[model samples]
Target: MAVIVTGASGFIGGAIARALADRDETVYALSRTDPEIPGVNFQHWDITEAAPQAVQSLAAKATAVFHCAGISSVSADDDALYAVKVTGTRNVLDAFPKARIVHVSSTTVYSSAEPHAELWEEAGPKDPSEFTDAYSRTHALAEQLVSRIRPDAAILRPAAVYGPGETMFMPFLSKISKKGVLRLPGGGRQKLTLTHVDNVVRAALACLDVPSAAGPFNIGDPTPYRLKDAIVTHFGRMGYDQVVIEGVAKDKALVTAKLGLKVKGVFKRGDRAKLFLVQYLQSDRTYNLSRQQRVLGISTTQHLIPSRFQ
Candidate 1:
């Protein structure tokens, strides 16, 4: 049976597509842009649009569908995010009615408005009103769509996913690191839930074999590494042992971000640095892994650092 993977050009999606192809699965790679992997059959279709006859035909033949395509930018506006994440997801479900869907979701759907000691997969849908970011809010809305349209669908909620093709943290760290010194906020003690791209793929493929209604599972590494420690360890492995990590108080970091954001036009989302500092660096977000470990039989602890480091 064939496997359909949307957003096959993206980091996580591309990895999943490659893994499936390696296992000799007939893979249909769907994306609006260019294909990232060579072996798979590439189909051009944006999920936000109505699926054309050709796309529908392809979806119909799939045994499983991995809905990995969506706008992930924290800087994106609500309307655009909604169009792709919510409406696009609806279109995928409509096109592939018979295929077992493994919706790639985010743990950011957990409400950040209130303090939670622990985040659980069973923590029901978050109210969109609670979140100010378009990515988080729209993802919550899209989850609602999956629950209503395909309750039996397996939804994998991964924390900050990082690996070889990671476009976020590594670049940010490299850019900010000055002569072996890296600056962090909150003493870099903020706990982070990071999932390797490989683990995410395993959890996703596992979902295909389970009962269709397996619901949502929180996918994250078993070890909750402090932001600074994780990055420093990674740097050391990369032969950058001289890296000296420094941290600033969370409140001071917020002030710096606020000042940096002031001169910039608010519309363009500022720069990556501003976004990272304001939205991510100063916080702690960790999720419960018991359900995923027990249900999926896949512990994400296999690779905490990227493969290059290993």
Candidate 2:
């Protein structure tokens, strides 16, 4: 039997595909570009369009399709993001109607800042239009589509995933620092949940293992880390000495950030939703993982941040 993985070129999907191959599973990796994983068959698939003929051939042999393809950039074009996240998802579902779908989703689908409250799975499905960021809105809409069409699909909503092969989390943090000072909204005191990529991989695989087990699962580390602490730990280990961490008011930071720029009379599309990052840095976003732990039997107690992110 075979299991298919979309977006094998990405960090999360690549890691998942590698793990599946390591376990001796016949892995069919679908991506426009090659993910270059050994022991896996590569298939060219453009999710926004029809699935390739090869996908249909493997439908009978395929047990699951790990839908992990989507743009995670907040600055990406809204139309491009929607095409990949929303339209692409529809195509994947249609292509693998008989296969169990293990959808890798984001926690951004929810718009909550409640303190000390663990965000339950049912707490969201917030309208996609509410999010000002491109990635969040499109991902939210894509998730909604999955829920409506395949309610029994395994939907894993992971927080800002950081770990081995991560290209987003730490890099984004690193870019925020200017000179020796790292300024964040609210002094980076807000506790944010971060799910390790390995945990997410485990959750996705568990869902594939138990095809009958479905619904949404909030995947994150056992404890939330303060923004300052996470930043300090990441930089401190990387030998980035003499860096100072500072916190400022959200409103002040918003004014300082050059969100959308204008040249001549026209405005540049250089991330019109830049303020969303500032808001997230100052918010308390955590998750409740009791259901995941109880059902998936996956505990993310260790492997918080690996030394070398491969």
Candidate 3:
């Protein structure tokens, strides 16, 4: 069976394509840029526009498709994000009407508050306020579009993903670790969850033939850690002496200045720094993956801090 993977140049998509190839499955990867990964057929197609005729032609032969392409950052252009996420999904579904789609989503679709243990698939509310960011809103819209077009599609909502090749917190952590001074946006007690790359790939593979895995499912390590603790562990593992700094009234002016300069492009002129800091420092987010474990038989065993980081 041939599999088509969108966003194959990205971290999660690339990992998924690599895993499928390792199992001897024929894999075709579609991305705007040619990825350096070997063992898969790479096709250049811009998902933002109408589905390329070449990609549409290949869709009829694809047994499965993993739609891993979407904008994840607040810095991305809003109209372009919607086009790629919402309209792009529509175009792909139109091309492959019968193909099983694994629409990779984000756990941010859930409420920012801690969810109850009973909050499983089909149990949580779909209210818009549950989502935290514009990225999540677009992802939710994309998932809804997929369901309308293909109700049998599988939805995989992973928590904040972290692993090798991760550019998000990894680089920031590296920079802070080198400086020996780590600053939390607020007091840094917010809870956070992470999905390791290996576990994410495993979850994607398990959904390939699982008959009961046709609904939305959350995927992540069940373990939750405070932002302060996670930062300390990450830096300590790198052989650095970590110092946590919380902004005080005395340092507020200096902190404000730094944030204003760093986030002027993304946020409005006045509150850019404050807005950027709150996303990392003040928010408490976590997810429940019981539905995934029960239906897909996939669970995470590794801690948030992997052995390699140690």
* Candidate 1, superposed: residue stretches over 4 Å from native: 178-180, 236-242, 266-269, 272-279, 305-310
Better of 1 and 3 by TM-score: 1
TM-score of 2: 0.91
Encode model 1's per-residue lDDT on 235-299: one tens digit a residue.
65544444677877777877777767655646754643454444566567787888887887776
For residues 1-310, write the lDDT of model 2, one tens digit per residue: 9999999999999999999999899999998999989998899988989877887788888888999998867777779999999999999999888888899888888883434358888877678777767788887898889989998898999988877567776667777678988777898888888887888888888886677778889998888888677766666655555367888897787665643332221644444434567667656888898978888887875443434531
What's the C-alpha lDDT at position 31 in model 1?
A: 86
* Per-residue C-alpha lDDT of model 3 across residues 1-310, encoded as one tens digit per residue: 6898998888889999999899888899988887767789998888877777888888778989999987645445668778888888887788778788898887656554443233455643256546544565677788778877888988888776777666455445455433556555555666777677787888889889585588788787767777676666655655546665564332464466466656774655443223433444445566667777888887775555646664
TM-score of 1: 0.89
Best by TM-score: 2
**Worst ten in a row by lDDT for model 1:** 269-278
TM-scores of the models, in the order given:
0.89, 0.91, 0.82
Judging by TM-score, tell me the better candidate of 1 and 2: 2
lDDT of 3 at 170: 44
Residue pairs of candidate 3 with colliding backbone atoms: none
Clashing residue pairs in candidate 1 are none
For residue 150, give model 3's deviation from the true position in Å.
1.4
